[model samples]
Target: MADRTITLLIVDDHPVVRDGLRGMFASAPGFEVLAEAADGREAVALATRLRPDVVLMDLRMPGGGGVEAITELGRLGLPSKVLVLTTYDTDSDTIPAIEAGATGYLLKDAPRDELFTAVRAAAEGRTVLSPAIASRLVSRVRSPHGGSLSAREREVIRLVARGTGNREIAAELFISEATVKTHLTHIYAKLGVKDRAAAVAAAYDRGILG
Candidate 1:
């Protein structure tokens, strides 16, 4: 059987990064660069139109961030898979991207062969993570607290620690007040607390918030 070509949409804020990725994929067999987007919003629009096999997403951008775009794509029930290609591997970056429905996470420093392999795996609907990211995830899972706060939850808690109300947090995060409340509830449960104050305290104690 012939190998299938996997179509990709490359998204990054830097023009050079996009050019490099496009060039790299163009030189590789069994891959096609269908389009490129400079930020998350454009990435979503193009992905929605092209329905590519995979989306190479950057985590942070001015227009929109990768996690929000991933969430939107999942909500829209698009068939394309998202593979995060970013420099950040912190808990704040990794956990939320996975939660938002990324098929894989790879750092910019990944070897060319490794990136190609990860893109192929993502196209096959498999979960792929770099060695460092995999190790971090393993550590989180093995921690005594089975649940770790997602990036959004951490944001909400950080605001709560500063005495920010639900409405303000909703405004800041561009989410609904109800969503903010829901995140608070999840934070409380994850931190073994019963309310916002306790949740904030617990988060600080656990170094989830600075």
Candidate 2:
């Protein structure tokens, strides 16, 4: 059987960076560049239109940028897996971007091989974390602050991490969908996260989920 070909869309504000990435992926086997976007909104629009297997997204962009693009893509039920590329190595950027539905994070300085590998992995629904970012994820998961999340919140977080939607969670837990939403609202506030991916990331970070 032929190997599956992964379709990719590159989303970055810098022309030089975009060109460099396009060049790097040129020789990678079983991957195709589907489109390129100069900003987050364009990224979302293009990804939506192209329905590529993967998206290499930049974290910072002007006017409703990277994180928001990821958020919108998630809400719209787009199938593209997002891999964030950025210079910022801090937890704030990594965690939030992941929360925004990015499947992985790679630093801007990563070797071409590593970036390509990460992108391919994400296309297959796997999570990849750069070494520096992984450490922060470990530390955050081990933080004492997360102990404050309630039992119900923890349950909701578990289900969410398993990719269960609110309605399904409500059905499984024998609660109204509104109740599930309430739980998620509290979960978000307690975790200081804005979306499902972030909640899942935080849960894994804190050793609360497998």
Candidate 3:
């Protein structure tokens, strides 16, 4: 390992979850817990101020919540790599978190070793996902239409299905926000679904990509 430690910010609404994560990282070598936040808005604020190497964010929170927070961070050009830590494992959650500039996603119940690996990968700006989660997501996209959407469109759909906003999607895909919107417009037109939620549901039914 390098001499420098990996700095982290933990964001979750539940005190126990945040405390547990903090404690977990505290015991691990080459890791440092720089700060904590209880919701998405606070996460954005704390990340802007602390500028940690990585953020472990929860997906669901009220009031400009988790995914939106990621979007906000990208809008401000913060360098923190987001690693989503949430209980939700469905395509609905995984795709959006990634779309919202998350370097990876992990379940709340993941083993300590996996979490440690994931955090390190995230810190290095790599996308990480539990094997099972990855398999499910890939299958979800691949099962439908078997390749109906273009790669970029599929990327847009995957993130859209996961509930990510255009800004987050753009950051994750390394595209401009306007371009992301354009992709969505095409996706919506092709999928014949008016909104992201519907596009996600339709993708699953049709097997367009997953």
Candidate 4:
């Protein structure tokens, strides 16, 4: 390994997670954590100012979120590489993040050594993914019925799985029936199913609806 240290900016919504990561990295050699951000907006700001070699980013947050921050970093011409450190392994979560410019993806449950390796590799502009996430991506690629869906579309499908009709689903979600229909339409298109029943089955099969 090189003698130079790899600087990092840790971004996560949970203080406990940030603290854990900070302690873990602090205990390890050749890893310097410059700062921690509670949300993606703050991460983007600190990253722009600090320009750490790697950004350990959490996908879901109160603010703009990891993918948005990654996109913003690119738009601002920041050279920092982003490594997604999140719990989500779904296509809806992973695909947008990759498309938004994440250099790597690793689950929050990764072993300490693996996490360290991922960070170091990401700093060097290499791509990484946890085994589970890689499997999800591979399965998604192999199955044409598996595709990404927006939050609203997911909500619609969940209700469909619950055997709720469009009007009832709309009322439960505070959206109009037409809006629910539109969401179902989009969901069907994305999931490659022709109707609500098939959509629900595909979603459950793909782990979109639990």
Whose lDDT is greatest here? Answer: 1
RMSD of each: 3.5, 11.2, 7.3, 6.4
Global CA lDDT computed for model 4: 0.85
Summing lDDT over every window of 10 consecutive residues in candidate 1, give the lowest-scoring window: 170-179
What is the clash count for each candidate, in the order shown? Answer: 0, 3, 11, 0
114-137 in candidate 2: lDDT tens per residue? 987898789888999999999988
Tens digits of per-residue lDDT, candidate 4, 1-210, equal 257999999999999999999999999999999999998789989999999999999987764567778878989989899999999887767876887799999988899999999988988888999998888888776875445786557767888888999878756654446657877888888888899889989998989877
Task: Summarize candidate 1's per-residue lDDT along 13-55 as a digit string, tens digits.
Answer: 9999999999999998999999999877899999999999999
Count of clashing pairs, candidate 1: 0
| TM-scores for the candidates | 0.81, 0.69, 0.70, 0.72
Model 3 lDDT tens row, 1-210: 256899999998889999999999999899999998988889989999999999999877644457778878988999999998888786646766677788888887889998999988888888899777889878766676533565568878888777888888866754557767877787888878898888898889888646
Shift in Å, residue 60, candidate 3: 0.5
**Candidate 2 vs candidate 4, TM-score winner:** 4
Comparing 2 with 3 on lDDT, the higher-scoring candidate is 3
Candidate 1 residue runs with Cα over 4 Å from true position: 146-152, 163-182, 188-210
lDDT for each candidate structure = 0.88, 0.81, 0.82, 0.85
Of candidate 4, the 10-residue stretch with the lowest lDDT total is 170-179
- Candidate 2 regions exceeding 4 Å error are 147-210
Per-residue lDDT value at 30 in model 2: 78
For model 4 the TM-score comes to 0.72
